[model samples]
Target: MVFDGLTETAVAGRPAWRHDASGVLFRRVPGGTYQMGLSDAEMAALSAHADASVMLDDAHRMRPIRTVTVEPFLMARHPLTVAQVRHWLPDYEDDYVDDDDAAAHLEDEWLDALLEALPFRLPSEAEWEYAARAGTTTLTWRGDEAPTEEQLLDRFGVEAEVAATENPFGLAAMGSLTERCADRYGIGYAEPAPADGPPVVRGGAADASPWQGCGEWLLALPASRGWQDMFTSIRPVI
Candidate 1:
């Protein structure tokens, strides 16, 4: 489905700057309010799932779904690719390596060009979920039941392919990746962001069993910083 919400100012041109990576595309999501996390009712239902697929303790941190109001921003159309990320920080890789190295080796020209091209930055979990939902209030983007890992693989595959058909909002890979964002880990609507912590990641990750294809998120422990393995990736927004 085509999304009507987006801004007029996405990064437009400059083909020579990009190499190996497909040029990033962003969707302008109109500002509005939406439920940011699991609701009390939804949590209760998960507690009662017959197979214990949704653990209560594991989900407790995401409780108290709050109505989040976001400002208009252009969200990346796909999970940030390795090539795309490498373009900015040459030494970066989507791995659990030292996060200090995540951006240690950077090309000044690429950085300047990126800033000039657009206001590129990672999306917060709130913004990420808002764009991912696009307007739906269901378990999966297009389903009534929770999705499975196999489902995620069958649909998106490894590397999180750029979606051919987008969600209702025209956003891609929302369910296929446990998208890493800019917020400090352990942050929630009920509390303030910590001074230092592993960044929170949104959307389910491919190969992450049940979590993939479903709306479960992960909080990167400090031990796992700079880790953007198959399950971790950034979705830039302005």
Candidate 2:
């Protein structure tokens, strides 16, 4: 999408900015409240599939569907590409494009240092879901049609390609990478998260060729959740 000044400031509270040094563009997301979990119909559809029950059993954790409010904040227009990370770590090496492709294999210490040096912070899980949905209440940001068992299972994997198109917010790759977030992993929305829990990860990285699991593919849905991966990427917030 075009990064014109008019588009950047069109929204009342939302605004956009560009980090010249790293060439990372930030888009302002207009904040509002949204239902943060699976709808009744979605639950019913998944439960009806006997074979997928084992793979999707934990899907209940997204339940007790709650209305969550998110305040307006800036989010990276694209995942932090390897090229941008190289601005801070010049010697970094990767096959992905410097400006266009998402960065991966980031360690926690590196993220901490990057946050310390930059004006950005990691987004919360709620904020990530809100941005991914971009105002749509659907099974996937792509649509509301409940996916057939075969469709959901075969749609994403090592063989699948992450679409380059943007969501309504003009953000790209919302379903591409398993992005690390700031929230602790929890059992369910109604249950409290253990203090020692692993960090939450969202926006399933279906392109990760090394991950051969069936469950992670379901995370491609906007409402689906998962834990951080050894090769998770970052989509910073400001």
Q: For all candidates, what are the clash counts?
A: 3, 0
Could you tell me the lDDT of residue 73 within candidate 2? 83
Residue 31 C-alpha lDDT in model 1: 89
**Model 1 lDDT on a 0 to 1 scale:** 0.51
Query: Compared with the true structure, what per-residue lDDT tens digits does model 1 show for residues 1-238?
Result: 2333332332222111211243556666788998767655455545544543534455546656777899987666565555565556565543432343121112235434443553467777778777767777655565435444444421322333334425665565565655566777663456776757666655544535444323332221101112233335455676
Off by over 4 Å in 2: 1-16, 45-55, 94-100, 145-164, 208-216
lDDT against the true structure, each candidate: 0.51, 0.66
Q: Per-residue lDDT tens digits of candidate 2, residues 18-128?
A: 765666767779989999887776666556544446436666777778899999887887677666776776666554333334444466676656656655789998899
Candidate 2: residue pairs that collide: none
For candidate 1, the TM-score is 0.63
Query: Residue 63, candidate 1: how far off, in angstroms?
Result: 1.8
Off by over 4 Å in 1: 1-22, 44-49, 89-119, 150-161, 207-231
